[model samples]
Target: MISINNLTFEIGSRALYDEANWHIKPGDKVGLIGANGAGKSTLLRLIVGQYAPTSGTISMAKDLKIGYLNQDLLSYHSDKSILYVAMEAFERQNQLHAEIEDLLAKLETDYSDDILNKLSDRQLEFEALDGYNVEFKAHEILAGLGFSEEEQKRPLATFSGGWRMRVMLAKILLQTPDILLLDEPTNHMDLPSIKWLENYLQAFDGAIVIVSHDRYFLDRIIKKTVESRKGKLTLYAGNYSFYLEEKELRNELQANQFKNQQAKIKQEERLIERFRAKASKAKMAQSRIKALDRMERIEDVDDDNPTVNFSFKFSKPSGRHVVTLDHISKSYPNLEILKNTSAIIEKGDKIALIGANGKGKSTLLRIVAGADNQFEGKSEHGHNVSQTFFAQHQLEALHLENSILAELQAFAPKHTETELRSILGCFLFTGDDAFKKIKVLSGGEKSRVALAKALTADANFLALDEPTNHLDMQSVNILIQALQQFEGTFIVVSHDRYFLDHVANKIWYIEDKEIKEYPGTYQEYEEWASKRLVKTEVKPEKKVKEEPKVKKEKQAPSEDRTRLLSKKNKELSTLEKKIEEQEISVKDLEQKLADEAVYSDATKLQETTRAYNSAKAELTHYQEQWEQLAEEIMELEND
Candidate 1:
């Protein structure tokens, strides 16, 4: 329930919004859609009073609770657990709870009439604000956002950028505000988590104004679409799909009107040119010119045509088999992710790795790409295999000092400047954008540049993890098309449902520490999963157990699968012990280094320093190996 009347917001010389009149009615789940700099997020900021509009008014109902979530998670709270951070959304209620506690404590010693009155007032406020259900609601929101119960207890500072965003999102949702202003809320969420958010938002009370590039997310949640362009806010009375359809029709009509007006003006201009010398026709020509000049001209609608075209420059093909995993069992000291999982990737396979968050999809991809070799698995690459690996953190690996063009040229030294620019254009980096330093680029821009670099690299095997995470719908479509046409073997780990369905011929569903390959697109896999979910399960009930279900290892410990699992577990245990011993040695060496007696004796100091340095180096080595094992185990446990 917000209203904007004659709103004008300017940034330096540019007016982002010009005399815009808009009404955000009650229960309006609005998707704010526009180009990168078209002020979608700016609108949210203006509404939230982050910055004042140059003119006009954005008025809302009195005392409206507004929860605003933008890109503001950079400031880390070192001591706050994820749960505590989320629970802080109920700040007012929490304060009341604390005040009530203080009052109760005061009553234990001595109580006055004023103190008792204050306590009742505070308790009433807490009850009114649902203070008792605060923790439960916080946990529910956190869990929906993919944070595990254990992860909830972890400090907020320990998480990466994506996870930290989830924590922020959980905080916003837990606030239960009357209005939610979220900008790119699903940017860091996995597919399942995105789905969970969509479901949550569907039933969310209050008004919602979201700015996102996720088409599917908007389609599922938004009821009204608001598009901003050229300092105008245009409303469409439907979802994203309906917006697209209606926009096309409106543009076509506008184009026709503009064209017709142009044709009539051209005719009038030609008439004036032809009959100006003739006095007889001069009168008629002057009248026609006056009429033409008086007519209001219709401007052409803004074009959103995506001009993207590119192809992957794959080198010679690899052998018939691209890569193979033989009885692979990757584990950490705490958990096992892949338990004797085996899969053969062929030379022409376009596999989409699909699963919930923390599944071994990305790990398995890295293992195959030869980026991570610590896992206990027999992974073999076929003959003449040339691979380009794009991890989800691929943007972080970019050379920030170099310009986008320079970065590309560094990777492809032989390619001409013109050719590099052309490929960059296909990825939406055009003209002067090619010269932009990677350090100055936004997250989405960095992602696009990374994608451009990966696609342009001379490789026959591509291992991309979440490649479409920051891509817009148009860019994603282009990427899908390019990947489809590329004559190379690729394994892509992605959560974008449309991208997966379009580009993948084989689906690898990694669940329960095993890879189940299906010979169909992701859509087909979804259909199969849906049917399986509805199928009657045969396991005995926990309350009334009729019989025990069969365990399907197919053999005893004599089997190779069993032996492989045993070996993996043994390796994990050994690595853990080795790391622990090394850590102790490092700590002991540090203690020796700290001793004043060792420093006083020069020879003893030198000896102790050498021992300390050597132990620290050895400890670092053991810790790395231990980490890889622990990472796999942690993933499996979380999954």
Candidate 2:
């Protein structure tokens, strides 16, 4: 378990965290979330000792181990195979294997009992460490992360940064440390790989702190949510969805209190102003003024979700058909991407191109955008169609020397500086942030600028590939709103299910080297696809006799059995009463803990938490006793 108490971390003049406290208990699954500049990732680094906090303590058990998977690991390169890299996590096992090999070689020449005994000991240690399964685990993890068996054998240096990051994640997962600190683990993952990871993490025994923008992924995995805001950390008792609802309620309460306090202040000010004009009431007015000064001022709640008011600009409308692909056949030396595949994109079509990695989603996007003409295909554009293709590579196309505002101005010459800055604000760049050079911006910031350029273009047909890569939840929501308001057509390739569900009206996927379309929203497509999979997977079962049934005479209870059943019923009744009392006690303690007044007081919160847990344990004990007695009674009555 890791405990972060009264933590204060500062960067230059800015305090990223001030008195932020979080306790990560054993088997705790937490989602760390905040705005773009809110310091979620920085806190993770502080915990792992990569960055030292300005003050306070982050203490963990002496024997505890941590495995961290971060974006910086993308730069890690090695000529060794990915399997070898992942197996490196088993340091002791690998050493024992090396020793065993050395001992075996010496024994071949010496044929000595000492060498034999050492070899036997090393082999036993290796077996005890489960060293033989290390390779299998590495392979399994690599495959789950979207690497093929052949790919696993390939050198780590051969893969791109994203794929390399997956290898690093595999290595961390293979370590099986006491805790995992994952920063944007789903960043480069495809849908299948993301789902596989979700399943894997669900079964992970250690604690996890995941910082991700994927709402669905957070909801599926984390049991607790922590928000970093204004140099303070706030804990939510539930997942992302629950946090959203709870946050809204808290905001409403705070807003109401603030409003009431402001009204009280205004009333007090008016009374003081009137009374100050009279010499007789001057003393009372002064006393009221002092009281008002001493009163605690309630801070108003800040708006977390900003509205999207910027509509995309388009010069002209396209014809009915936006894009048409005919008999497309694309192939590499060994892998066939598309074989005689065809698809059509019509006006106003919001298509989500999704599938497993290496399924030609990007390749198909390139073909559709007319960015790639090497393939054998008949690709045609509609009349008066203007197209803008947005991809990760476009980030490299940005001018590093230009300021954020200047970059947008260069892309959209028609827009004024104020208009460009306003556009930048929608992407989370505000005030002095827009003046920052593109070279200094983070990957997510660069992504926002690129997406801003793409949306600002005078194009009616857009081709977006992984547009939500580094965006936060709020930014993604802004993009969704912008896309929903736009009249243009687009085909986006993203693994974010939440973004897809909101923005896409149709789903496109590659299957059997051909383009397939489901003429429905992403949610509908998921339901249909899951039902199809079930239909294919399920087989009819033949009826079989379950077991021999008890005879009617045997089912009749004897006098001794009846007495036992009566005794069990009495015990079960008493247990039911005790269980009810304990349940009420637990609920009372829970309600007390839920109160802000109680929770804000450390001693009260601790006492209530302990009492709640004890009450819960007592209730569980009574329920178990009741179940056992009820089962025994059922058996006795049957006999």
Candidate 3:
């Protein structure tokens, strides 16, 4: 539905895209992938018309609706409830409904045929747009995005940035635009909500273009992958995993070709050098030199970034129990974030906290770390625990004016100038980079600095919240390696599935106002979660049967007709109840099949699908029995 012809976009002397041609057809779910600074978000803005290409034509069908969700958006503040904001997407439907109502009011008096015809047209348009279910649809969208009914009634200003983003997502989903351009849509989402979004997009009819770092989300939802590299776009069929394998193979081939070309060039140069010393072979040598000059040299691909390597060396070991929380409960006025929460962090334990955006995963982390104490709980740390807590808002707490080196020096007072500089260097702050003021650092740079500071402390236990937020893939791997090697206890709250899958030894799922521990990796947690959800949805089918006494009386009635009728009535009531239970079972199985997480698990998914089918078959059997019983009951009543 949208086409870009010979697109060229540049920022000052840098060219983001040069003569790039691309097209997005209807129902295309494309994942935009690129390295840091590859202009993925910039291209998204270009497609949405937020930024005009320096040169090229972007053509789309006239009047085609498009929705763009940018990373940076103004906080929506109004007295209107969240539901009202979501319902705003169907403004046309609302307007048509209002017009219909006005027309009906006018119909009470003498109205012209022309007015009546217009009213009829408006009514038809409203009905065609599903105007009657606008509110219901809006509510569904909100709930799918993880908003509770009470939250729906809350004002927009009462929510935090992450919650506000969910509201925006709800608006976009409810709008159902012809094309959706989303940038890091899962940035503020938890595992469960991310699952919801995946299902929503999988069933979405319109084309979708997303820029995200969440591999699991993309792998499950997107069918096509578009990668930006070296001022060009490469399209790959299939999901993120497919793209990864293809890209690796392609890069290896390119590297081999480059090496071969370099070897040939060197060989040619060596032959020319030897022949140049001989007067008789001077012409041949000159000819060879000209060939070397004219030959197009293959450019070598840039090497991957160096990994940030570090090891924690503690002076003394902490007690067996690093930290413990007892009956922790926190609430903010009307919102109860955490209640009766208890967890124990032992030395050498790596734990991952998982939940939806507003489920207070971070809050729980903070409470455990003793950073926030406005709660009714006893949080105790082991002797000489030496704890370090990394909050999501750590960057805001930094002294921006201090140089990176100075910041580290202030945190590690015992370290010499050289020691501090060496520590900063490990985090990519080299030479003058260490001297740069923190205020001028990029988001990624600031994140690195914060992480460096957190690690510099001789803390045996680290509590990090979204530490991988601004880091690139390379940096994330480096941090993962560092954390994996550390002997200290680690409790991190993050949404990056890959990171969690690689580093976490245990998964803590926070849901339904409680925390449940899963003693396995993220993949295992996913499997367990899928099975649990299916079991939760599978209901027992109810059975219906005719009363034995009524059945016997049908063959030999006459004087006992009233007794048979009473028995028949009782049997009918029992059959109705049984049918109702069977119906509930069928609905439960259907819900299980429709759940997103069930589809995410490859192994359990097949089992769940089979189970769902079996349940459906069982339901059908009960349905047939119910029908037969109904017929028999009807005959008895007529008699």
TM-score per model over all chains? 0.81, 0.83, 0.79
Candidate 3 lDDT (Cα, whole model)? 0.82
- By TM-score, the candidates rank as 2, 1, 3
Q: In candidate 3, what are the lDDT values of residues 1-639, reduced to their tens digit?
A: 989888899999999899888789999999998877889999888877889989998899998888888757535677789999888889899799788888898888958997899998998899899999999999988888888999899999888887888888888888889989998898767777888899999999999998887778889889999988888888999899999788788888889999999999999989998999999999999999999899888778665555545556677789999888888788887789878978788888899998777778888888878888899878899888988899768899889999998898889887788777776766767788888999998888899899988988888889999998877666776678778877888899998898999899888766656666765578867865676567557622211243445666456456566677677667757766776877787787678767888878887678877877776777677666654554444345434
Off by over 4 Å in 1: 76-78, 111-125, 301-303, 536-639
| Local distance difference test values of all predictions, in order | 0.84, 0.90, 0.82
Q: Is candidate 2 or candidate 3 better by TM-score?
A: 2
**Candidate 3, after superposition: displacement of residue 172 in Å?**
2.0
Q: Per-residue lDDT tens digits of candidate 2, residues 362-458?
A: 9999999999998997999989899999999999999999998888898899878877877888888888999899999889889999999998888
Which rank order by lDDT, best down to worst? 2, 1, 3
For residue 116, give model 1's deviation from the true position in Å: 5.2
Pairs of colliding residues, candidate 1: 332-629
Best by TM-score: 2
| Per-model C-alpha RMSD | 21.2, 16.2, 15.2
- lDDT score at residue 103, model 1, on the 0-100 scale: 95
Query: Which residue segments of model 3 deviate by more than 4 Å?
Result: 75-77, 277-280, 331-341, 413-431, 510-515, 539-639
